[model samples]
Target: MTPPPMITDRDRDVIERYADGATLQEIADGINLTRERVRQIVRKHGGADAETSRAARQAAKEAGEQRAQIEFLAEYEAIASNLAHQGFTRAETVSRISVLYPSIDVDVADEALRASNIVFDQNNDTDVFSNVALEAGVWFLLGSELRLKPDYAWAAVNLPQELLDELGTHLSEASVTPDELATVLGIIGAAQNAAMSDPTLTITGARYNELRSELLDAIGLKSATGTKPWPPTRQTLQKRYQGWSDALEAMGLATASLGRPKGLLAFSEDDYANAVIDFISAAAAAGAEPTFAFYGEWVKEQAADGTRRPSPASVRNFYDGWLPALRKANAVVAARSAEANLSVE
Candidate 1:
């Protein structure tokens, strides 16, 4: 039998490639050797550092994929942004991209569209970009300094056909993100609801903050500490609108007062009594003491139900003292329990 070829630098190269995940045939084709000859060389090297070579090869593959993704995003941004500015929806833009670039997958096109920041209605098939732009105009006119202009103010409230035509043409071109559109619209809704019960066309910044918190509670969006909320923060709104007053104006509302009204003024005497009774009853059910501290924490928790409970201080103020309030609440709870037991018997 003929002996295998003696180990050479070329053969060493073959061994290295094999260790780096090249097949025997692939190494042979590169080095002008037979597949069997390359395999013998790799075997003689005892597959030294093969695992390390494999890990390095995987790292290289990942790096290549990341590079590809970066290129894809850059290209997609150019195409999608232009389409969005021209009034194309995400679905429309994505469809066009898939046809224009047959190599790109539809899913890849969808991902690129989302990252492009080209606003599209994620909630429905509706044209969110156009809708938001038009709605924003209404609020913008309502809030803008232009509202002081006689012609514009009449148009702002009346929204006549000519005003609608102008707003539709102008505002439909504004660039706005989905989150911003949702938040501004949500604030508008909350303001309208608040206005129904009050005799004011404007609300305080403090009241606005409270209403927003209640909005989040009603919508089931959790607000984490140090993180942005669904409707975003007041600071974010200010940045977007150029100022808090401007933002309120854009929501078609004005600033009524500067600070929060003290003592949960929205609640009445019966509401306060009912809240105390509920707290003591809940504590009794859980076999826990209805301490003032616990009641404060409980009130915070109850906010999730969209019921604005009094602060611990407000509760004290309402009853004239903490211990006296607790005693009264406890008595009410006890009497209710007794009545329930009698009814059951």
Candidate 2:
């Protein structure tokens, strides 16, 4: 009753193979049937198959185990770029993701992290420090830059619960209190700022453990066995962060945002400049001082053909970067016009 033999040809082939002294396992392998099913078929065809030779069975068992191991490994990949983009080591991104997605086993995450080291070596990348000294050195400099005490006396902040929730602070981490949450958030900002100041300082070790150990050591924030101060684990950082966006938001710093930042226009830089100047000139011609709202309306109308390309934040940046240049140009034009009039007179 092996699902009602739908193919007579396949059944005949199995019977012939069994009659030719093939072992049940060999026939099953070739015909894609379970060995017991093959054995039953062989018994039905007038002669019983021989017992599996012990040595062959052992080999089959090893082969099956090897196959399983190979398949299990396929559950994760060890690519370097994959790890860097995830920032697995510094942020405990893997652990957090595992918490978020229950099926992602920790072993798989570890394998992926280790694989990144191999990939990093193969790719000849130096984004991560080659030695603990360098990583520690970087951490000391970064912590100093932010003026954070290894003990969080002068530099701690306290956010309300709503902001804490928005920052993704889970209850599990010791960051339950506001000062605790602020201390870690401060560290994250400090790290980001340090990376900005020196691109090499970007966290790049293949795993969070390496980063955690290095940073804690450098800052003398020992965990579990030191006299000075205990440091936050990578897990703690993850409890309050979804990445730079949330980190910045939590700290009340400027941000690009989860979606597109407000006020980025599709206009080319030159077009954007012209629109700003035109908006200002039009406002002046109307005997009204140019303002951010007027410029926003100009951007809205110019980009209205299909989309509002420039976000408000980006427009604010444009105003910040180019308005002074426009003012300078206007001043120069006025000076040249005055000189020409004097010469003509």
lDDT of 2 at 192: 35
**Model 2 agreement with the true structure over 28-56: per-residue lDDT tens digits:** 99978899997777566544335433445
lDDT of 1: 0.54
Q: lDDT of candidate 2 vs native?
A: 0.45
TM-score of each: 0.33, 0.27
lDDT per residue, candidate 1, 1-345, as tens digits?
967657778767777777677766777888788978776777776664556666767887777666665677777787776554333556877888888888876765675566554444232322222333333333432332122222333333323344344433332334334444443444333333333233235544444445445544454443222122333334345445566665554443435434233354777866877888888778889887566677888898899878788888888766644544655565566688899999999
Alpha-carbon shift of residue 290 in model 2 (angstroms): 26
Q: Superposing all C-alpha atoms, what RMSD in Å does each candidate have to the true structure? A: 20.5, 17.2
Deviating ranges (above 4 Å) for candidate 2? 1-147, 150-163, 168-182, 186-345
Candidate 1 wrong stretches, greater than 4 Å: 1-6, 28-37, 46-50, 82-92, 101-345
Q: Kindly give the stretch of ten consecutive residues in candidate 2 with the minimal lDDT sum.
A: 222-231
lDDT of each: 0.54, 0.45
